[model samples]
Target: MNAPALKSKCLPTYLVIDTSSSMKSHESLLNDTVDHVFDVVGNSPRVAEFAHVSIITFNTDAHVVLELSDIETVENLPTITCQGTTNYGKMFQLVKQRIDADISGLTHDGRRAVLRPAVFILTDGEPMDKDWATQFNALTDASWRRRPHIISYGFGTANATVLGKIATKAAYLATDVDKEKEAIVSMLTSLLNTLVASASAQEFRIPDDVPGYTRVPIEFVD
Candidate 1:
């Protein structure tokens, strides 16, 4: 019998989380949610066969907590540290550069090119950076062809205006940040499902309603 051939096409998924001081109170919650997400994806044969996952955390500065790797290879998801002010520009720039480098690496390694990447961002506060929009726009430039589909999520205290600009396809806001425990759980569960589905998908689709979130439609600047 022949060994199974590896899947040719791959999907890259980025999870960008906020680690500003405001999020300190929810450290445990964030940790557990991320743990569950990684566990679910790592164990799913479908996701493991088609997806590469990465984790990024940002506050005053942005850094990659986990570099892009096959989901199956993810052992420990880093715990985010809460400090400094939120700077959206710093995060966008980091992602843009990393994605460019990552895609190049994948192609060089003789792997089929990745489809448009998917980015899931979670933040609970407003951005403090001036001119953050410029960086965000550059990152989502449609001309790039490989531009990612960004799905932004805001906790209760998050600024809807900023998130609307950050998200490419959808922006979801929680009713009450940490107080609504059930809602938060539901939202995280829905996010996990979305991430897993995107691994084998070529297009993006948003759920009508994510148990604990309300869709906030955004108008992209031309």
Candidate 2:
């Protein structure tokens, strides 16, 4: 009789980006940074093995740019186009849906032990939808077993209060408006560093502080 294959733990990581009109000016840089992050993860065998990445972009509506995939096997990364309004409600709903589907797919055959998903949200503007919080609350409900650990990055006209509410783990807001480009770079860099560290530690880890941004205090309801 043959021995059973050992199961490895996998992290379902989502990169949620706001592709609203406000981000149009920095679209090229945004796409490049996203590609770079993927390249770096693909280069690292351990990180590639542990972190299954997915890309979700939202503007007037939300779309899944890439399904949860093993970094090493992905041949081409999709580019993000900046347009439309920033609909936070749609984004949150899509994320919740994706988390449910992705988790089920990952654990279907018992081949991999799926860890709690982590979502990295990068946005440059405020939510256009007033009822966005309803969707957000549903996505982050503590009673839900697969609720993701969300880390949000804000820049340009991004709202700190909104970021604080959106993030379950950590939130960061740019301190200087004049240095928006730098802030974007720093946010993506911190994400890459967090992934590498988490993979090595075999657990999810977030930076205590991010450069060009200040950590926002997340409020909890008792």
Candidate 3:
């Protein structure tokens, strides 16, 4: 019998961020974190050469702050703001729509490609949105052809159990609340490095550094 074949990849990466009021306390740090992440991902030759980056910032409402496209100039990304509540439902639904659009646009006539859409969501509080389970399930099930890779992180008393549920795997936690701002910034940089590195190699692994990084109970299964 033939062994399973390796799949080809051209994964278009997507970042779904949480910019809720809970982040207001760490607004300055959050801004720096996002800025740094963009730099890390956009500046890397591997990511810049092959990956299309899309950024989605969510609060009480979800919005597509940026769409799927090659980021030739990372500086061109609009400055994101934080306000409103934590509505995971809005975020999941909006992202699902965008994923659909991307898959819909793909043409089989092109090279053999696998578009792995990845999402990285960071937050510091509980969700304020109702009926989030519906959208969350739809996204985590991997029914979409783009098959998303979602990394959700929580900090400062966020419900690890709940966030973990949304993310498929347990969510990572930035446990240093007293220094939560800086800690989150560090995680952002680290995660971006992982994303870009994966894009460049066309293959990747989670927790590339081999540190458990305080991820949630759901992730413990791994």
Evaluate all candidate structures by whole-model CA lDDT and list the values in order: 0.78, 0.90, 0.68
On residues 1-222, what C-alpha lDDT tens digit does candidate 1 reach at each position? 985454467777788888888878777887887788778878897867677878899999999999988878777777777888899998999999889988887776666557778888988779888888888888999888768888888875787777787887788888744474554466667777776666557444456677667788776632
TM-score of each: 0.89, 0.95, 0.82
Q: Mind giving the per-residue lDDT tens digits that candidate 3 earns over 1-222?
A: 984454345566677777887677776776666666677666665676556677888897888877876566655667778899888888888888888776555433242575566677777778877688888767766555555777777777678777677665336776644566666766676666666667766775456331334766564222
In candidate 2, the residue pairs with backbone N, CA or C atoms under 3 Å apart (3 or more residues apart, or in different chains) clash, namely none
lDDT of 2 at 34: 86
Off by over 4 Å in 2: 1-4
Q: Give Cα distance to truth, residue 37, candidate 2, Å.
A: 0.7
Can you write out model 2's per-residue Cα lDDT over 83-198, one digit (the tens) per residue? 99999999999999999999998887464578899999999889998999899999989899999999999988888998898888999999953678888889999999999999
CA deviation > 4 Å runs, candidate 3: 1-9, 73-75, 106-111, 208-212, 219-222
TM-score of 1: 0.89
Name the Cα RMSD for model 1.
3.1
Estimate the lDDT of model 3.
Answer: 0.68
**Candidate 3 steric clashes:** 2
Candidate 2, poorest ten consecutive residues by summed lDDT: 213-222
Residue 124, candidate 1: C-alpha displacement in angstroms: 0.7
**Residue 154 lDDT, candidate 1, scale 0-100:** 84
